[model samples]
Target: MNLLINVFLLSVFFPYITVIKSLDTQPTALFLGTVLFLIYFKAEKKQNRYIFYILILSILSIFLFEKSNIMMSIRGILNYWSLGIISYVSYELFKRNKIKNSIIKRSINAWFILGFIQTFYSKYFFKFLIVGMRTSDDRGVTSFATEPTFYGIICIFFGILVIENFKKNDCILFFSNLLIQILFFSKSSMVVLFLLIWISLYILKNISLKAILFSSTSLVSFHFIIINFLKDTRVYKLYIKSSDLKKLFFEDHSLNMRLSHIFYSLKGALQNFLLPNGLTQWIEYVRIETLQKTYFHTLTPTTSARIMSGFGGIIYESGLIGIIFIGIIFFCLKKGLKNKEIAIFIIIISFSAIQPSFPLNGFILGMSIFNLEKRRIHKNEKIKSNDCCRN
Candidate 1:
């Protein structure tokens, strides 16, 4: 209960982000220096030592490879500690425990009220909190979150919790939250749409394999057909004007940026393939900056241009080893991997894949899914055991 409160209220409310403005690359660090000091010592119970092992493996990566700018790499680790560790610990606390319906109701109510404030969203609204939660942003409605994408993830997390609680009022709140997300026009609006459709499909139980294949095929075909039609008509030109939005709707920036990040990252990996630079974009930027510093006197450039892509960032930071390290966690998670596991993976990846920096967020989201699946399996096991004894 304390852990839950810490997560929903303390961690979310008091992210207390500190930004280091550097020409190489700015480090946007989220750490609570003193807010959760009261609850810091309370050790959380863990059913499995999964996260501990993952952390250990992360530490081992540094020793296995060239530790360039070790302090900066340590900061990357600190980021993982801040976001991943806290999220995983909170998930573990909730996994075996029953989240009270009252808590769910209150949370939903809070989200609903917060969503309402977002309708009047603007920079001014975002500047001053109408309530305890946030309001708007230049990007979109943030509403208790620092960013629209983050807010959308939180909303979906709340939706999942609401459904798991099996409350009718909470169901209404979830849908209403989705409506608010749509109103916000967020980059993460895609996640909201996908979750809504997929979760709603729960009503149609036991879909045949043929039906599933046909439905998926038709959806893809129709999506492309519409894209082509839009191209012909140039309707999208009118609707989706922003270049970033244009990437999602019609076109994307040159793959060169993504390629450079990936290629250089892999090259860095080759130097110490066992481990690479820590997964921080700033590391890549800083690395180039260092070379530029050394060659400042020479009328020569030392670095190639780089762009931030999520997949590229993973390769650049953690390398082949880091990929496998994270992969192993998922591999071990097969024990409780559910039928909808692929869908969940797709949804989370879809949100992350488009972003600049995603590893920390991905870790938190991935662990959340892992814990939810674990709880589900436990619930099923309990039911099966009870039935066998009753018989």
Candidate 2:
């Protein structure tokens, strides 16, 4: 059951599946919801306190912003509550005997293989397979997110798995993932690629000249393939626009718009810092108005903005207090990264900044933190309980 849920969640971001467009969250949600219900009814003890707190926060946020439409309120509530449920369920699974290291290895392998296939299609076969599909502005395949950055994030996740496996001497798996990352030509994935390699070497305390040389070579080789060889390809054109790249990173206008959105949200946050507008009103007032002016007709109101913009959205809907609450959660998780679970937690938090999918990222973050803490506690107990006998 846990494996199924993980696969479903992983597939939610896969780029080649058309069905994902209409029902991206449904499969995972159904599986998760079922598990949640089963746990609630059958467990000898209730779920943890954090789960209860998350539920309360969701419910309270809804009531506090009662003016929101039913759909908005429901989405808002689910967005928060889903995180708690996912975290709790993942922790439960990790605690069980079924989730051994081998299981995790298999799961990671499956995700990498799937990702590789998707990247191949996006790079070469997407047009033949799905006609009339258009790539989004950020060069993502039309079947999933409009932006390539979304897929890039997924590729990065798989890439991390690859790096970890490679460090453990799983050469074939690492190279396979490396090939897929190159095929995708996603800038975000490239960034993550380097970051993961650096982290892996650093964590293992084995940073050597060979590792640095390999990293640099891989990056250069990827650039040559994408830029020099794939330049004339249709998907390449759609998914790798030079203009979007320039604007996303170097342009002043883009930065200004994000800054303006953040400032406005912060202003609203301060005014209604305790209890703010309902979800619908918040969306209309902040997202719609802000995008209409700054993004013009090119951008959708519901699309995620920069980090500060998301922070602003929270403030607009739930006020400064709510933002602070969420901020506290993030801060705690960051501190907890000193534990071994840092890899997963960092992955989740990083995605949260880049994607507006909410509870998916939040849930992953929470689970990673919980699992890491559990590992740390267990290790400490073992050391303390066995110190005198260890001679």
Candidate 3:
């Protein structure tokens, strides 16, 4: 039963699974979690009063402020409530020892392996392994992910995990991740790489001038190598567009949308007293005339849209409530890993870049708590060994 729950939780991360793809990822995760929760039926209770409080406040906010749009308000409530439930259930499972980090580690390793396989057989037989495999993009390999950005984020996260663990297969998995990131060549990949290095250095006991020089030299060398050898990839395209800000803004749809989301969502949050306009109501905050001034006025009320970021969604939808909301969720997640700060840094980084996925968020929180417990157990063992040595 515990193993079943572990697999179900891990399934949330691998969105490309055919069964999940056919059934839809988020709802399936929620449904399976619900069933497992009912079957296992642990009467053990944990205190998550803060989450419930935020939910109550958010529901009340919708009624008080968003009564004008009854249907959209309901949608907002449902979205928020569903994700809250997922986070709570995940927290409970990990807290109760139903989830395991070892399984997560294996899954991450498998993802990297599949990434290599997909690089060669993407057009031939990749679909046999992953659903919705794209055949057109020759720029890079995305493994089972839907896009380069998602793949990049996954590599950074699991890459960190593998590095920390130092298993016999660590070198192979680490290099495989690095190779895939280079091939993917997306902005998110490069940005995450830079941030990871910076954070790793910052976490060290001392920041010497020599270390800084070496880091700069390595980064410059890497940039030059990419420009000279991987010129056919998207990084070179970004380099060429860097010369003309106008072309960069107008030509790159991905950058344009990202910038637009950040700018408009931030503007909306400030304009609306920092309260979210309601879930999926980001369109309401996006003014057509204002958007037309920037030439991104292509949005419509009926268009399916989100703020395309975690903080963006939180701030745009809940405003000031978002602070309390994220705080509570973060608290539930625990410190996570030895370098808890970096783990959180990566979470925020990914959340801000990717569209909000509740299942993924829940998994992250659950996994963090699991890591905390693992760390405690290891600490206890070390203490016991020390006592034996003293005796």
- Model number with the top lDDT: 3
TM-score of 2: 0.64
Candidate 3's residue-wise lDDT over 180-260, tens digit each?
554443334345444545455544633688767766776676677667765666666776677897877788776666666
lDDT by residue (tens digit), candidate 2, 1-391: 6666555444333333443344333335434544654664367375544444544564466565354366556666555555545545544554453333454355445544544554555433344432333443344232233334444555444444344323556646554654454355443433344354545544455357876676677657756765775555433453354458555434434344445556566565666645676566554555645644543333334543223344455566677656655655565454444433444344333423332333335444445455556767788999988996886
User: Candidate 1 lDDT (Cα, whole model)?
Assistant: 0.45
> What's the TM-score of each model vs. the native?
0.57, 0.64, 0.73
lDDT of 2: 0.48
Per-residue lDDT for 178 in model 2?
44
State in Å the error of residue 67, model 3: 9.2
Which candidate number has the best TM-score? 3
Model 1 misplacement above 4 A = 1-9, 13-47, 58-71, 95-105, 108-112, 121-123, 128-139, 163-169, 183-275, 279-312, 331-339, 342-391
Candidate achieving higher lDDT, 1 or 3: 3
Q: Which parts of model 2 have CA positions greater than 4 angstroms off?
A: 1-24, 37-59, 64-68, 100-147, 160-167, 175-179, 182-226, 229-271, 287-312, 328-332, 335-363, 383-391
Residue 26, model 1: lDDT of 21
